[model samples]
Target: MGGSTSASPCSSYQPSPSTVPFQRPPSRFKDINKNHVRLDLNSMVSTLVSDLGSVDINLKKQRSGLLKKHRDSQYRLVELQLVVRFPCFTMTGTPPSLFTMPPRRRANSVRCGKATQVSGETHRVTEKNGNDSLDICRVLNGMWQTSGGWDRIDRDDAVEAMLRYADAGLSTFDMADHYGPAEDLYGIFINRVRQERPPEYLEKVRGLTKWVPPPVKMTSSFVRDSVNVSRKRMDVASLDMLQFHWWDYANTGYLDALKHLTDLKEGKIKTVALTNFDTERLQIILENEIPVVSNQVQHSIVDMRSQQKMAELCQLTGVKLITYGTVMGGLLSEKFLDTNLNIPFAGPPLNTPSLQKYKRMVDAWGGWSLFQALLQTLKGIATKHGVSIATRCR
Candidate 1:
């Protein structure tokens, strides 16, 4: 799951909401310094994680059905959690300060790319396609960690983390059927939210789960059964979005699978999307009249493949792009910015699965020297803007 096989993009690097192009004002960068940027980065991450832990504790209690008798009382608890968490995540109406930047233009046009203001402070992406469209958070919490290549996660902790992310206005989540325990965790989180929060608040949360099945004979029974399994696991009557992926394009059954999914959209799914599909295949799917809203792909500064042909196809077909690998598995951050170039091979190995996977990408994208140069440029920009390199990348 860690290697690019997941074809996962980082949950960061969402499209900007502003219709007008953003040119960072020169005046804002005049007073920035490295110390200030470092402080802000450390403080921001620490505060987010710290506040999340407290909210997670409370959510764990609610998930355990401790507040069923006093549902009305639990509403205030939910509100408090949201109020505390929202400021940490959203960048609504903020000035061009060190920590805030306008949304970046994506390679492909994203539907509902604009952020809808809810309560003046919170922003959510509201797809403007009549009744079928959904309002979701731009930053979707990627759950591939549950799929593997990461540490073992306790079920309660994972569920609590989902609540933390949801309560923070990061309501949209990305998961797949193959990701072990991910759908189950969302099911638990959604059930807890439904039991504890009011309808309006619960509606703000969106789960964008995926259905990546093996290449097989696409029968109605087969497709329906697969969709039903996810529904049962997520404890939802209708899924917010189902992003389908196929391992082998040689098998033309993917079209049949999508047709069945489209049929089930009447009641089981709100939107149908694709994952890891190239331009030609995507065009073929659209030509067949399958209503795919978006295509998820591996997109980052390091990997600009999507911008070449996929962006044009997406622009023509009205399919928005949901990109991952935007942060290049954390390589675009400050930790590696000025490290020693010469080291014994195999002495300091790439530790995480993400690191190992993206290292290959770094090599292919002009090797270590050029990558280090890019990182240095990013560091300069971050220092100039008084923000972390990660913030700049996003």
Candidate 2:
């Protein structure tokens, strides 16, 4: 960000869409691997359409059950429209000038096609440490897909995809300890950046990971060892940010863990944050002076629970809100607008885990009829601006 380049990183490279399918080894075809099922992205989508019953069953066993448990209230009763719009980024790529949070509350304006630069605005989520600070990208590339259950991931292909995203001016990545191979993939991707890309490019790239340990003893040694494991997997000297998640809030081990995380920030950690932490617990965390920079939560048009109680606390404490589920797992897109899910082959199937989960959110927010009306409104707005509903939602 300090140095100016004649050519923006995105200006030089336009990543071509990868049409090459992952090739499995011939040895895998042997009797030893006869039961091995290899499903690509397309096949996964098709499977979701064909086998809704099985998908429903698997959705019950989602890995992020604790997060779901906390966010279940989002669907209780549908609230009126949200008056203000908060900052969000697309999963695809965001412009260089667009950082996390803009100082001013800008209107929900839309621009078609290419990214429009918001000149003279410093939109970043700052994690202050005395004089030093870490400026994170407004939209983070969530790597939960790398966790598993989606499809088979080729390591080289996945790393290439990461590089393309970084080259497109999207460098911030979010992952977690429980998300299998996410940290490992970030490690590989960052190394590739260091070796292949410009030095400044690596500077812009940030990897923020999470630590979701069970309700266990939060000993100094245990915490240190756990953080060290992530560091090693990420191949970084010090972690950019280590977000903490606690399953059973009744167990006061969360406070101990955050305290240990705060202590580690002096050396092994740069910033300590929280994931899916509600308002009351966050207030307690602040009262204890845990020094949390931000709280990552589910804040979307459909789910405005974060804006109700949490916004006041965050505003007062100067803690930023990093939101996920901004697009409702692609339900906000034109693919589902005006389509009927009641008919067997009418609308696009809720195939992916995100779609399946967020569909439930839609159901809780209101029935399909209400959601269709909301989608219709969004489509109208997007049409007026000459952009897709997905872009408008983002």
Candidate 3:
């Protein structure tokens, strides 16, 4: 909320809109092991428990009814997967669900290999024809992770990192109209790409952003203005993709917003995407025949809730799932590795209200004890594959 927007500071907080590649002197010193980049997770957890030892884990309060059912199914699927493979746990008194084996992270075994040049709307992700040809990097650039205080990002360094990622063939972008100046930053990068690269090369960069309006009455002018604001800030004449989000469904002004947005797309504003729309509501949108290409949602090992139903639904609707929170705010990585439940974490204070909200989620889904088991399980998997636990989530 601590943004330049005239609204609540945290509510509208914007970071430096996309900066062309950031320029920073490369550190000459030995690089810290990527696996252990943050402060000690174990110590932080201990301090945290000492401070809020009596605090209850906030799990069930914030999510929609649709999310719970979806998440339950995913958890059950995982349980079934584990039971089939590790009958030992099932034979023991403990059920597979209670076994608490952390999900493994094998960095070398990601399904997506290095992508090559884009030929058309679809690019060949692999040499094989039928592996997976998702052209828009299913995982777009995430600015939300930068919003929370889980890590300290050097702005200049971060910009340079973006350049590196783009060079590596991960060009599709994932951002929100409200994610500070992420859209603006993407715009700046695109302009630079247009100048430095050939026209064909420049087309590889596609940005997908969201428009999250308060649940309220929507008019054509209001919707157009919202898109215009993003266009002006991002300095783009046409948005490559526009995603939409709303806080309350009961209000139902979202329909009006979507109708107008689809009009923008028809007008060649770019593709339309959705962020965090539950499957039921998503179905409603599709039932009405609203066109959308992707739905951005929180999907990670701990939150495989998306897999419960979204994956199947996506297959049915031909929509792709662009996921975030797969890393659990870095809590899923080595930062929390070997961390005991008693310590509190120390990182930059969170600016996005969602961080605080999600911390409550960490409380639920099995508190520190359950989380500890998950982490231990992940550690085992990480060790098996020779990669950090973080890479597994990625």
Candidate 4:
């Protein structure tokens, strides 16, 4: 909503897609521990190469094609044979820029040895053979605020804010076509990365955007045109990741759309994932032989639905779960701890879209009283750890 898309802001160039090699983890791992994720380069090479043939044929081909493009590069085969793993969080050949940030200025942020830092926090980054292969920070910057209702967003200011986040090692960004000016801002930001930052910085910044289309006949041309528009707006030869959202399941056109999206993985998109899809629909997609790498869903402490059915399916099928709303749109913070909003004008108003949306969720999850108790408990834990509730959320 803050930039122009009359023309591409920057020229598109092909960046070699990188993959991480991973084996399936035990199903008992309910949560990902960022500090413990490490890759065993030696073990990963042979196992990943051997496991390639037995996995999803389409994904194998995709990884094979990406690998061929980087055959000549000095990319090492990294083994993500960690104890706690997510199906979607694995990697193969390491990108040169991903782990090579300078130590002096970035010593606190980029720990190339154990884990990659993300905004002073660490997240587990892994990949599965059947899932998406691209690398990203576990904590993503959701750009829904760009759609509207926040404030008048200055284009230069928005781009500068993005640069600050990337520079802080919080490089993975999540946006959508409907999020006005988000793709445009990303286009300008990425061009700046290409021209100003080092190649490593460019590799670290991932723009994972979503495509939410109406329930129309999902012809190849229709899907291609839609995807091309995002590519043009983002000014990227290939999208880092495309997360698709469909409104209606009765139309059944989502399968066709996903098929076409799967075909476009040749060079147009690095990874294809889903957004707001439930366990049943996800199973249907997987049953139809679609190569969906991850399913982006609303997952937070207050809303644990994804952990119930979706987590089981994902764990069984190796599909990664990309979660959002983990902070309950900031309602989980200390700001809401000792306040009561129901008493006339007594507390901070749930004015923002996110705040209002999650306020209802807080209500349904046993109302403000229970939520306050939960927040108080969390605040106590944060105090014990010498971290704020927001920091604990990160």
Q: For every model shown, what is its TM-score relative to the native structure?
A: 0.68, 0.73, 0.64, 0.70
Give the winner by TM-score.
2
Candidate with the larger TM-score of 1 and 2: 2
Residue lDDT tens for model 3, 1-394: 0111110111110111122112211221122111111111110111010100122233233322312222223311111011113111100100001111112321121232333432233321211112212245433466654332334545456556666667766676666654444565666677777777788766666666677666567899988987887777667788877878766667778777888888886554667767767777777887777777766655444444444455556656566555555555557666665555455444434334444444545665445555655566556655765666554221
- Candidate 2 per-residue lDDT, tens place, 1-394, comes to 1111111011111111211122211211112111111111110000101000111122222212212212223211122232323332222222111213334454334332443341112323455533335777655788766655466667889899888777765567898775667788888888999899889778888989988775788999989988998998889999998988766667989999999888888789988888777777888888987788777766555554555556666766667667776777688878898998988889897666667667776665545766676667666666765677666323
| Over 4 Å off, model 3 | 1-134, 145-158, 344-358
Model 2, 369: alpha-carbon shift in Å? 1.3
Rate residue 84 of model 2 by lDDT: 27
Native-referenced Cα lDDT, model 1: 0.57
Model 2 off-target regions past 4 Å? 1-125, 129-132
Query: What residue pairs are clashing in model 2?
Result: 100-138
lDDT of each: 0.57, 0.60, 0.49, 0.60
lDDT minimum window of 10 residues, candidate 1 = 36-45
Worst 10 residues of 2 by lDDT: 43-52
**Residue 257 in model 1: shift from native, Å?**
0.6
